[model samples]
Structures are given as C-alpha cells and as structure tokens.
Target: MQSNIKPVAYYLPQYHPIPENDYWWGKGFTEWTNVTKAKPLFKGHYQPRYPADLGYYDLRVPEVREEQATMAKENGVYGFCYYHYWFGDGKQLLEKPFNEVVESGKPDFPFMLCWANQTWKGVWFGDFQNQVLAKQEYPGIDDYTNHFSSLLPAFKDNRYIKIDGKPVFQVYQPLDLPDSKVFARVFNDLAKDNGFPGIYLLACNVPIYWEPEPNGFHGVISYLFHSFRFREKNTVFKEGSFLGKVEWKWNNFLEGKAIERRKKPKVYKYEKVVTKISKWPKMNFDYYPMVVPDWDNSPRAGNSSMILHGSTPDKWKIHFHNAVNYINNTSPADKFIFIKSWNEWAEGNYLEPDQRWGTAYLKAMKSCL
Candidate 1:
C-alpha cells in the first residue's frame, strides 16, 4: 500500500494571543476562545470539541509546536502548509510560531506557505456586516517587492517544501488579487532573483467555479469545502413552529439589521458531499485532490453556520482512499494531496486528537497513506 502521494495539511496559527486579535476579539483572545464558547446547534452535533492529547496547547510554547510537528510526521503527513497573512505594506498576523520555526530550526519539519489573501471581517463572530478589521490591499510593485523580500528568509530556509526543485507557494484566493497572473509572474521572478529555482505557485480552487487561466501558477489545489459546488437546492433547514417561521421570515427581511440572525443552520448530507468530491472529474492541469475529515463551522458561524452532518472516521477513510486512487490513476507524476486542515478546531475540522475520536482521524490518514 506504499504510495508516492505527498500529504500537506493546512495549519492555522491562531492559537496564541496576538495584539490584532486582542484588539479585535478582546484581550487574551485566541481561537481557543471560539472553540470554548461553541455550543451544539442540534441533536448529534459535535460541539465544544476538546483537545485530547494536545490539551488546548498554546502556539507560543515551542514544545507545543514540536509536539504538533511530531504528531503530523508520525501520521504520514509530508509537510504543513501554514496560513500566512500579509496585508499590503508588510503587515502580518499570527506569525510568531512560523517565525520561531524559521529562526530556531527546531522540529525539523518540511513546510510551505499559503497566503490567506483575504480581507478580515467580523463574520466569524456572527457580525457579517460592516465590521472590517483589516482590508487586503495590493499596493502594486513596491509593496509586492517588500512582501517577497520579507518571505525570502523563509523561502530560502532548508525546511521549506518544494516540488521539482521549485519552492511551493499557494494563494488561498488567487482571483481576489488585482491580477493573479501578474502576481505569480512577479513572485516567480523574485524567487529566481533570490538565487533559487522558480516558484511553484498553486492556486486554491475556491469560489468553486473559478477556472484556472494561463496564469503563472504551476497547478491548482482543490480546497475541498470551497470546491464543493453545493447549491441552495441541496441545502435544507429544519422547520420550526409557526411563530418561529414568521420570525424567521421577518429576520430574513431584516437580515442586515441584526448582529446575528436567529435562523436554523443549513445542513447537508456528508456522505453525499463526499461522494460528489470523490467522483469529481479529472481536469487538464495538475489538480491535487483535498480530503476533509469532517466540517462543522457552527462554532464560528453559530445558527448561520453551514454544516455537513454525519462525518465519521470510517467515512473519512473512504474519502481519503478515493482521493488517493484518483491521484494514482490520473496524476501519478504530481503525487500530491492536500488535507483541508491540521487543526481548525473552531470549524470542527482537524486531525489532532480530540475527546470523542481521539486519534482515529490520524489513524485513518496513516492507514490510507
């Protein structure tokens, strides 16, 4: 069952307290805050998912980071694709863990960066209206040069993950850029100028229908949830009492006026979603399949959350096997698979040990690999 497929799990570095987070969410605010406050929206819905082995570890602790690296490596993950945030003019958020990794060179894990190039809003806290925390700005070539220069140190680090002698970088929302093709070209040239092989830019297949153009990117990585072409037709909301229904209708009319809408969460069948993703048609370019163990963002979005119900480790294993088979049969040369996350607990998507499943998800990943 040996396979050449390289698995890279997307890592979120929001577990530690940062000034921006403190300002936006309050003092001592971190992702744990959201995770702790999460409540189950319906029957059988997993909520307040507690950390088992890791035990709600803080990212500021070096030992915690080392433990994460060890766990990931042991579970057959090839590397971590950390979510790197850089607002124009070189402003960055949640960079302490990765910066330490670069400076200390501990853990010795292979890693890459995916620019989460999107504006920060209050949507996570159920404030979907007019609470712009940080706006994503592309200040043209000068800012781009500064951005590349800042990453040069990490890019040159020996631990950086590369493909075919080129350093790999992913853009979470490539289409959001002023001109994605131009951005890729500049970054590729910058990598070359810094005395390395050209960059292997990967565009995330978010916005579902976004077709990759003749951009400078080498390939596309199918971000599982985002690539899901789920329609409103397939979604169903649980019905409520007559008054509740009238209130819901009224709330829908007053959607923008409220801090949070009191509406039933949209739910989809996980098994059917998995089937659709596993059977996705092959594309012309390098399309790296992504496997999501489970997803339930009710913690972040509350009642407005979109959830995929009924995701067991067994079902996840089936999805993983399908993705692996897809790669082996269609794109053997690329041999890459992206897991939606390593630890996005607030979204109920993680591979880390949890109270209910313990290390079952990791076991499934290791077994599938």
Candidate 2:
C-alpha cells in the first residue's frame, strides 16, 4: 500500500432495519430490498448485484462490522467515511452501526463522518412528486451548536480519521447549507474549544463547477463521477425522414418529463467516462480526486438509474491508477483519494466482494495503492 496516499471509501450504514425505513418501505426494509429486486433494463446490463464473501449480512451483528473492517484493512483501504445523516432538529437515520462502533470500540478501525445533509425524497422509488420523507432544515445557530455537540464524542475518539492533527468532517452538500461559511467557523471554533487541534472540513464537489472559496471548508473532495451524464440523444434517424424528427422530438420531450417522473436511467461507457475525468482541468485549491469501480443504480432508482456499463477490474485499475498519479504529481503533500464507496450495493458501486466480480474491484484498488 502507498504510505503517503490515504484511501478512504464511503461507507453506507443502511444494512439494518430502522424505524423510518420500516415505516417508509414496509417491515424489515433495508438497502437489500432494492438491491435484490433490481432487474436489467437493457442488453448486457448488470443487475441484482449480490454480496459474496460477506453474504446478505445485517449490520446489527457485531461480527459483520468487524469482518467489513478487516476486509477493508486487508485491501489497502486506509479508513471509512461513514455517511452521517442528521435531519434537522437532531433526527438521524441509520445510526446503529456507527453508534455501535463508537460505543464498542471494536475492530479498532480508522473512520470519519460525512454529513449527508439532504432532504429525504421518494425520487428513488418513482415517487418524485409526492414523497418527502424528511426535509432538511438548518434552524440556524442553535441547531448547528447541537449538531457539533452531538459529534463531539466521535471527534474525540482515538480511531477518528484526521489530517494535520485535526479530525475530518465532510459535508455532502456544502452549497445546500444555509450559510456554509458560518458552519465552518462555528464547527472549527467548537473543535478548538473541545480541546482538539481543529477540524478539517471538506466540501463535497457536487455542483461540478464549484471552486474552493472562503466557504469555511479547508478543501474540496472531487466527487465528480456522480455528476457526469454521458447519454446523448439518439440521432441516427434525424436526417432520414420527417417522421424521425417528430419521433425524436417526442422522445426528448418524454425524457424531459421523466426527469420529474424519475424514469429512463442514463447509461454510459465507463472507460470513456473515466478517461474524460482523468483529463479534467486541475483545480486551484486543496482538491482530492475520487474514483468509482462500477456504478449501476438501477436497484435504487430503477429505470431512473444512471448506469456506467463495461466497468471491469482492468478499467477500474486504470481509473484508480490515474487518480493516484494525479494526486501524487499535483498535490504530493496532500494525498487523499476518496473512493465513491466500500459497499453501496443498491448503487452497484462497491469494493466488497460480489457474486459476479468477487474481490476483483478490491484487488484492483490494492494494485493501485
């Protein structure tokens, strides 16, 4: 493994049943519900991705969490950035796994948190219009204070991931925050007041055009893969007939409407997408690159999924190596490559062993490291 570069994979803590999940999706609802029911939308489309080595395990089991940590450690992953969701007014979902990790202190793994500060919507299940499960609200200073206070335990934990003596906390949607600058100032001050060195606040690169500014964040983690939409209009019949033009226009109109209906998932060439990202212009600030092994969210979003086809272990290795090389040459002193995920089976983007490509993606990551 590379000594300088820190490889932190995003960990989704939705394997266990939660009250909200039970209410929103029936009893015993978890990510596996969507993952297991997914079907291929087109030819050669990968679907119903199933776990292999780990099997269909529940996160409530202590041994399951331990095994995950062990596998991550063995595959050259430095740590996990657990997706931390804090709906306004202190309401949180999927807190069982990380909570257990914090309280038990078992596995002795390095970790951090990325606040997935977004409102819960039913867009995934084709209810884009009427379902608002949990709305995100930033009720100003008091809420921010409480939020920081709540995270104090994890920030002070010995196993927390840190950079330059400061515990790392990432914001999934920094721009969504009412006032990001205030958040950074308040959180940083809280860190110092709590007797810690400081906080390394990272802003996720969501908007794609976002630049590193005085937004209270120390750096930006380039999560660009999710933003790329590579599907082009099918124009093969554009010049042949008037009927073709009308049909094309109707199809385009339908697709535009589908944005709201959450229909028609966009598919793209994985190799082309990776190559395009590798050639993207360099950022001016402390920027960390990211990589996705393979992405097919048909499980979660159904036809509304964004699928990246033809993503083999070989292709992943190329993408991973390019990210490593980019960070090494551009910002050698600040080495961080955030993989999109460790195990997000619903999205089909994970390093965990799966039935089709058992440990192949993990091996590719290790090769790059």
lDDT of 1: 0.80
**lDDT of each residue in 106-222, candidate 1, tens digit only:** 779999999999778787565566477888999998888889998888889999987776888889878678887788778888989988778888888443344565767777786
Clash pairs detected, candidate 1: none
Off by over 4 Å in 1: 1-3, 206-213, 229-262
Give the range where candidate 2 is weakest over 10 consecutive residues by summed lDDT.
230-239
Candidate 1 accuracy as TM-score: 0.89
Q: For each candidate in the order shown, give its overall lDDT on alpha carbons.
A: 0.80, 0.81
lDDT against true structure, model 2: 0.81
Error of 2 at 191 (Å): 0.4
Report the Cα RMSD per candidate: 6.5, 6.3
Off by over 4 Å in 2: 229-258
Candidate 2 structure quality by residue, lDDT tens digits, 91-134: 88888899889989977899999999977778654355546788
